[model samples]
Each structure stands twice: as structure tokens, then as C-alpha cells.
Target: MDVACAFPTTLDTPDNIAMAESLGYVRAWVYDTPQQSPDVWMTLALAAQRTERIGLGPGVLVPSLRHPMTNAAATATLAALAPGRVSVAFGTGFSGRRAMGYGAISWSFMDAYITAYRGLLRGETVEWEGKRMRMLHPAGHAPARPVDVPVLVGALGPMGNEVARKHADGLYVTFQPPEFMREYSWVPYLAWGTVLGEGETPDSEHARLAGGPGWALAYHGAYEFGGPAAVLDLPGGEQWLAVVERSPAEERHLAVHSGHCVELNEADQAAWDAGGHSILTDVTISGTRDQVRRKLDDLAAHGVTEIVFQPCGPDTRTELERFLDAAGSHLKPA
Candidate 1:
């Protein structure tokens, strides 16, 4: 399996991308939550300038946040800067939109958006807002026609998976077990929070704290999809539901931003802690080095082609280095 690092698009993102490249990570995925981090495309442009071998792109850009034309142009520009080292993943808005007090875009919108975006990237004119448009750039200034960029779709449900299979090169799923992917056929790119410390097992407190935010994200996703009732079946789901129940209806959507591993505030951290530590063991790959290696092997054997590791905690660089030390041998050449 190939390893990728997902960053929060902070000021240090380019630095981290360069470090990850040197450490043998295959890709660097920048998050697109504009309210929380720097501009994702600008960060990616810096990453492209800093790193030579690693792939760089938005882990999943929200289609609703920008016009398909804008996304196509920005991606084409990045592809020009990085040449063959660019790939993009699109998704219905999550933190990027919800943080702005909106819900995810409809699947139909995403399907149409991907179609048009792909067409525009290939230097073909695509109909947009009742008019046809194409990226206009001089031959030497932009990537040549038929830009070879792989587009993936970030999805969590059956409808999203279907859209990805139909319109995208692959599927980017979060917190899904390998067995789930084996049952549903698609090129799988799995994203999980990874926490590795000396002598710490998957159930350790340190591990739980490191991986808890990812579980919290799953809880939030479940609630968004099916209301509080949908998440009741998950471990510690009742607690998350209770928290949501206590919030006023007007403020509930903000809960979607509660469990981000990269920007957990005190309140969010407390809420995640209340969800119980074992929730981390269920949703994340957290353990000692040998245990993490075993988990990586299991994921690869079950059909995961890429693992995008979201390293959490205050010292991200340390966490990333430890994660690479444990699993870097499994990284396939880009």
C-alpha cells in the first residue's frame, strides 16, 4: 500500500510536505477548509515548489464552494507547476461548507460537477452556467491538452460510492474497515488517524487521545446523514447524540466542526473524550510499531491501494516521523 499524508493547510504545510517527501510518503493531501486553514491551492502550489517526488493535491475539494470552472482552472494550473505529480479528489462539502452553516451538496450536483470539471481539465469546452467555457492559457504557460490528472471522489455512503465509481478514478473513504472495501469493489484510498508511541497499544490512553478526533468525525458524519438516530449504533454514539441533542437547532450544524484532528479546541477535545477511548480503537489505526505494521499489511491484503495518514496531536512532525518509521517500508514508489 502507498502512504499519503493529509495536512490541514496550515502555514507549515509546505514544510511538512517536503519533509514527508524526504521520508518516503507518496502523496501530500491538503484539506480545503478555508475558514480553518490557509488557501488549499496556494498551499499546494508551495508544496509543488518544495517537493519533487511526492504527489500533491486537495485531499477532497468541496464542489459547492467554487464553480467547476474555477476548480478546473486551479487544478490545471497546479498540474502545470507540478507536471505529473498532481491529483485531485472532490467531495460533497463537509467542514468546508458546514463551517459556513450549510449542508453537504446533493449527489446530483457532484456528479454533474465532476463531469464538467473533467471535461475542462482535458482542455475541452464544457457548458457552465448556461454558457460554454474552457481554460484559456498559452501553450508554454499551462499543462498541455488532456492533462493527465487522476481525480478521486471522497465518499462515505452507498450513493457517494456509486457516484465515485461512475465518475471518478477511485474512491476516498474515511474510517472504513478493509472488509467493507473488499465487499464493495473500487480502487480504495483509505484515510485514518494514526497514533504511534513507544510501547503504547491501540487501547492506550495516549493512543485514544491521538485517534479520538477521527472517531468523532465519523460520529458527526453519521449524524449529518441520518440525524442523531443514525449514529446510535456506533460505539459511544449515544454520547455524541446527547451532545447534539443539547445544542439548539440553530447551532447544530456547527457540530460538524467539532472533531477535526488538526484543530481540536478544548470543548471539542472534551466532547471527544466523553465519547470513550475505545472509539479510537474502532475507527483509527493506533498502536505500537509492530501492531501498526500488522494493520497496514491487513489493509493492503484486503485491497487498499493507498492509506492517507492524518497525524494528530500538538507535535505533528514527531507523530509523522514515528508513523513513517513504523510503516514506511510498505510505501510503494510513486
Candidate 2:
């Protein structure tokens, strides 16, 4: 099975990225969170110079947060520096307007961003704000290792996935099963599977990890195409947002943290299975290596091309050591 380790969205450090490479991770994925974390592109650029072969990119950059022109420039620069190692995943970001101080845009905006971004990558000159611009350094201009930079769309629902299929080179999903992915044609569907650390208790590691920044996934389902307002149409959506908005920080975090485990329940499993989602749907690869190997094996059986492991909490080095030790036998050679 192919595996990669995630950089904590808010608490990422160079030491953690370095450790992941030493532990045999093929790709070191980072996140693009505006409110509390360092900028994803700059961090990845620094990380690019620090590591040799590991892949790097924002697990997601909210399309709504910046113009596609800016994204195009930044990604192009990274591709130039890192060559074939950069993969850009664009998506809708959600937390709360309070945290980021901005409202969400519509799905139509997402379509425009992808179309424009891809066009630029192919050396097509696109018109923006009454001006025509193309990639400054076209793909064929330099022999600096032909760029294999893939633009991954952070898809959460069928609609988003379908749209992604029409434009993106690959699809990056969070907390969704392989069965659902089977319906799509995107070749590489990378799932954000979190491998909870081992501790004295079954959920101790998970709890500590949950309280950290990546906790947004627990309350909110995957990446928000927009803010809470973006998916108000989803089932139990408005009520869920209401809870997130009104509850105190601690209370809201507890609610968000618990949502992830709900996906593991029998009813949820039956619903997901009935919907044709493969058994590799649960994104958390917690517990011992023996246990995680079962999940990894199941994903391979279901045709998962890559499993992106999002590590959380403070001690990334310790967690990474445990993960590599347990799953080392299953990994492909570096």
C-alpha cells in the first residue's frame, strides 16, 4: 500500500517534516489554513529544500480565500523549485467566519477556479480582469524534470467529486469510502486517513489528537466548499452548524471531536455500504499496527492507490515511529 504522512495544519514544524521522511513517508502533505497556521505554499517551499524525494503540497487551499491568479503564480514557483514533486489540492474551507473573518463563496466559484487554474498550468493564456496572462515559464521551456504537478480537488460530496472529475488531474477525499470512489473515474483518489497514536487507553491518543487543530474534520464533514453557510442544505446541516456556532469553544470542540467516531458506528456503516461506498471508508487508522494493517489491506483490496495519513497532536515524532514500526512491512520501498 502507498502511504504518506500529514503535517499538522496548525502546529507543523520542520522537525516533524524531517522526521516523516526519515520514517519512510513518500509524500509529506501540508494544509492551508489561514486563521491559525503558516501559509501552506511558503512552508512547502521551505520543506521542499529540506527534503529530497518526498512530495509536498497543501492538502487543500481554499479557492475562495485567494484569486486563482495568485494560486497559479505560487504553484508555478513551487513546481519550478521542487520540479515534479508538487501536488496542489484546492477546495472549499470551513471553520467559522469568526475564525477566518470571511464568508464562503458558491460552488460556481469553485468551477471557475479549477478551469482557470488548469488552463494556466497547460500554458494557455487566460484572460483575467481584462488582461491576458500565461504561465511565465511554460512547461516545455525548461528541461528541469518535466513537471508532473497534479492539481487535486478536495472533494466531499458526489456533486463535488463529479465536478472534480471534469477538471482535476486527481481527487483528494477526506473520510469517504472506496465504494463511493469506485463510481468516479479519477485515477488517484487519496483518502485522509488518520492513524491515532497508541496510549494506555483505546481513545486516549485520539482524544488528545482531536482537541488539536485538525479537529475541524470531526465536527464538519471533510473540507467545507464554503463556510457553515455553504452546506446548509445538507441533512441535519443547519442544526449542526447552529451547535457549532453557539456552543462555547470547549463544548463545540467536544461535539466536533465526537463526530469522527460516529462514522465508525454500525448504522453509519450500513448506510455507507448500502450507498456503495467501499469498506475502506473510515479515515482514522487508529490503534495498533496489526489493527491498522487490516484497514490498509482492505483499502488495497478495494483499489486504493494512496492512503494519506493525517497525524495530529503534539508528539509527531513519537507517533510517526509507532506508525512506521507497525506498518513498515506493508510500505513500498523509498
Candidate 3:
């Protein structure tokens, strides 16, 4: 399996991506949480300039955040910088929309948006909002049309997988690689958690910092999909619900999704303290070097072509380095 590193759109993205390139990572993907991090395309552009071979793009672009014309331009601009190294993926919003008190978009909307977006990239006029639109960049204005980069869809259910099969070149998934997705030759899996050090336990300070944000996502996800009662069953779910309940009903989402995928906020810390550490060690990729390697092998066996790791917390570089070392053998494909 190919190994890649993803970033949380931190200021250190360019440098971290450079580090990944040097360490033999095949690609560097940055998240698209506008409210939390820098502009995903801008951060990716900077990263592109800093590295030569590693691929760069948003891990998963939330379509609701921008007009297709805007994304087409941004994708074209990055294609100009990185050429064949550019790959873009679209997904129903999670952190990007939830943090803004919005909800995920529908597959139908995404299909239409992508149709117009790709039409523009292919130098064809497409209709949007009942008007004709095309990438009108003149000579030296942008990469000559037909940007022709790979398109992927991040999915969690059959609807998304079906849409991907129809519209995207590949699939991007987080958990449970479905049998239907096996027909696609390539699939990318985004992994969470830290590689535990020798003799270190799951509750170690470093593990918590590096992987707690992902663990806390459980609370956000459970509550978002199901309700307070749904979240009350996870490790520390009861306390986490209590913490979220502290906020006013109208804007409680602000509290629930505060530290999403980047850091652990006060509510998350409360959950962590109330026995949520198990969630980290249990569901995330936190394990010894050997154990992490086995996990990658299992994912590869299940048809995951690429394993993308996003390092979180304070010392992200160190976290990346540790994961790199832990994924020693799996870094290269068979």
C-alpha cells in the first residue's frame, strides 16, 4: 500500500508536506475546514512550491462551501503548480459544514456541481444557475484547459458509493471498505490515531494529544446523527453529552464541533477525562509499531490502496515522523 500524510490546515502545512516528501510519502492532503484552518487551496499551493514530487490537494472538498467556478479555478491554479500531482476529492461536509451550524449536502447536488465543475476543467461550457459558465482564462491566465486531474468522492454509505461509481474516478473512505467499492481499482482510507511508543500505553500524554481529537469525533458524530441518547453510550458519552448540553440549544453545535479533527477543546477534554481515552485506543490507529503495521496490512487486504494519516495536536511533525517510522514496511507497495 502507498502511504500518504494529511494535515489539519495548520500554518506548518508547507513544511510538514515537505517533510513527508522527503520521508517517501506519495501524497500530502490537507483538510478543508475553512473556519478552523487556512484556505485549503492556499495551503496546498504553498506546500506545492515547497516540495517536488509528492502530490497535493484538499483531502475532501465540501461542495457547499464554494461555487463550482471557484473550485474549478483553484483546481486549475494548483494543476498549474503541480501538474500531474494534483488530485481533488469531494465529500458531504462533516467538520467544514458542521462547525458552521450547517448540514451535509445531498449527492444529487454534488453530482450536478461536479458535472459543471468537470465541464469547465475540460474546456467546455456548462450551465449553472441557468446560465452558461466556462473557465475563460486567456493565454498565461491559467493552466491551459483540460486540467484532467483525478476526481475522488469521500463516502460512508451506499448512496455515496453509488454516486462515486457514477461520477468519480475513485472512492475516499474512513471506515468499512464496502464490497461494492472493491470494483474500483484504487481506494484511499484516511486513518486517525498515533503510533504508540515502545512501552507506552494508550493513556500516555503524547497518545492523547496526537489522537484525542479523532477520539472526540466519536462524540460529535454520534450526537450529530443520533441525539443525546445516542452519544450517551460511548466511552465518556454521558459526560460528553453533559458538556455539550451546557451550551445554549440554538448554538450548541458550536460547542460540539469546536475542536474537530485539530485539537481537543474543553468539552473534549472533559470527555477525555471522563474515560474517553478508551475511544482513542479502541477505534483509532494508536498501537505499537508491529500492531500498526498489521493494521495497515489488514486495510490493504481489504482493498485500501492508500493509507492517509493526519497528524494532530501540538507537536505534529514529531507525530508524522513517528507514524512514518511505524509504517516502515507498509510505506512501499508490494
Candidate 4:
């Protein structure tokens, strides 16, 4: 597996990047949220300077939140700084800002935003407000020279997956079986694996530390909205987001399976069974190094090219350190 450390947009401190580099992690992915977390591009640039080989990017930034031309410019600039090791992923609402006291935005707008953004990235002038807008200075100038940072789109279901397949260089997948993913033939798949903690007691603590409450809210958003994919291209989707916001936190969060940050005995021992670890293992990648290796190998068998660790709990540094220790042996460069 191509193991990379994920930094929450909320908690990514400079020290975290330094530690990830020392431990041999290849990338640092931060969340992108205007109200909840730091700016993804700026944070990534700072991290890029701190580490030599580790890739930097947003786990997923919503295009609706910013003009695509602007987003492309920012990402291109980061690529200029980091050269070969910059990437980004885009997604729809995972955090319902309306739930946290804000107006909701629609998915249709997001689609248009991506279309416009891609236009700018390719150096085509986009028609805007009875006018045209283009990249001020595209990174690639000569015909032989081209900006090559990989762009990924988060795909939780069919709609978004299709979009990712059509528009993005790859797909950012989460909480879905590799078998299911294969049916779609998604190339360059990046699986999201979150680890809360380690050791015998990791399961329970990982649950609490993962802020079960916050994820519960996210779950409610997905479920009520007919999975994250269902909302894509849905007209007035923010109306549904508003509903989830009104619902109580406890009502929305319901565990899909046992264990927390790490794996259960059954999950580790019988991961290859029909159900295996896929469904139940939705939210995390906790377990011993060997256990994680087995799970990642399973994903690889089904075509997951990269595995990005989702950092949970209060002390992200501690969680990342443990992950490095457990999974480092398997992350040897191919």
C-alpha cells in the first residue's frame, strides 16, 4: 500500500508534518472547511516546505466554496513549490455547515463549479458574468512542459464515482468494499483508512477519540441524504442538509459494526470472509501492523492504489506516530 498520513484540516499543526517526515510517511492530507478548519492550500504550502518527499493536499475541498479558477491557481502554485509531489481531492458536503449555524449550498452549483475550475486548470478561458476568466499564468508554458499534479474526487457512491471517473485523475474512496469498487473499474483509487489508536484497547478508545459524535453527525447526513453520492447533482440538496442539521446528534449516529479506532478479533482473524472486513471496517483502519497489512493487501487485491490514513482523536501526533510504527514496514517504496 502507498501509506500516507491524513491531517484533519482542523488539527494540522506544523509539528505534525515534521513528525510525519521523520517517520517516513509519504503524504499529508488535510481536510478543507472554511468554518471548521484551516485553508487547505496554505496549510499544504507550509507543510511542503517542512518536508522533502511527503506529498501535500486537501482530503477534499468543495468547489462550491470557491471559484474554480482560484482553486486551480492555488493548487498549481503548490505544485510549482513541491514539483512532483502535490495532489488534491474534491468532494461535496461531509460537514453540514448549516448544522453548525450556516446556510446550505446545493450540489448543482458544485458540479458547475468543478466544470469551470477544470476549464481554468486546462488554461481555457471560462465564460463568466458576460465575460471570460482564465488562469493568470498557467504553470505549464511550453508544449513539452505540463503541470502534472494528480487530481482526485471523493466518491462515496455511484453519482460521485462516475464524476470522479469522468473528470478527475482518480477517485478518493471511503467505507466501501473493494469488490464493489471493482465493478465500476475505478482506476487510481485512493482508499481512506482512519485509525484512532493502537493495541488491545484501541477499538473502544478509537471510537470515542474519533469523536463518535461528530462522525455520527456525518453519518446522519449521508444516510438521510441517501448516501453522500445521492446528493450529487440533486437540486436544492442543501434542503436535505438543513434537515440533518435539525435532527439530534444521537439520532443520526449509529455504529455500522463493532470496534472503534482499531479492529476486532473477528475482523483481524477472518478478514477474507465473504463480508470480511469491508462493511464493518468502514470508519477506521486500526489494528496491529500485520493486521493492517492484511487489510491493505485485500484492498490492493481489488485495486486500491493508495491508502491514506484518517487521523482521529485529540492527540493527532500520538496517533500518527503509532501508525508509522505499525505500518512503516509495509510502506517500503516499490
- Number of clashing residue pairs in every model? 0, 3, 0, 2
Q: Estimate candidate 3's alpha-carbon lDDT, on a 0 to 1 scale.
A: 0.86
Per-model CA lDDT versus the true structure: 0.75, 0.58, 0.86, 0.57
Task: Single out the weakest 10-residue window by summed lDDT for candidate 3.
Answer: 175-184
RMSD of each: 2.9, 7.7, 1.5, 8.8
lDDT of 1 by residue, 199-244 (tens): 5654555555556566567666677677777777776667666766
Q: Write the per-residue lDDT of candidate 4 for residues 19-100, one digit (tens) a residue.
A: 7777777777776666556677887878778778877888777766676766787877787778778787887745424323
What's model 3's lDDT at 170?
86
The positional error of residue 18 in candidate 4, measured at the CA in angstroms, is: 2.6
- The candidate, 1 or 2, that scores higher on TM-score is 1
How do all models score by TM-score? 0.87, 0.72, 0.97, 0.69
Q: Which is the leading candidate under TM-score?
A: 3
Expressed as tens digits, the lDDT of each residue in 196-315 for candidate 2 is 444433334343343222323432443133555653533334545655556575454334433232123222222232331222223346545677678777766665656776655555
The CA-based lDDT of model 1 is what? 0.75
Span of ten consecutive residues with least summed lDDT in model 4: 253-262
TM value for model 4? 0.69
The residue pairs in collision within model 3 are none
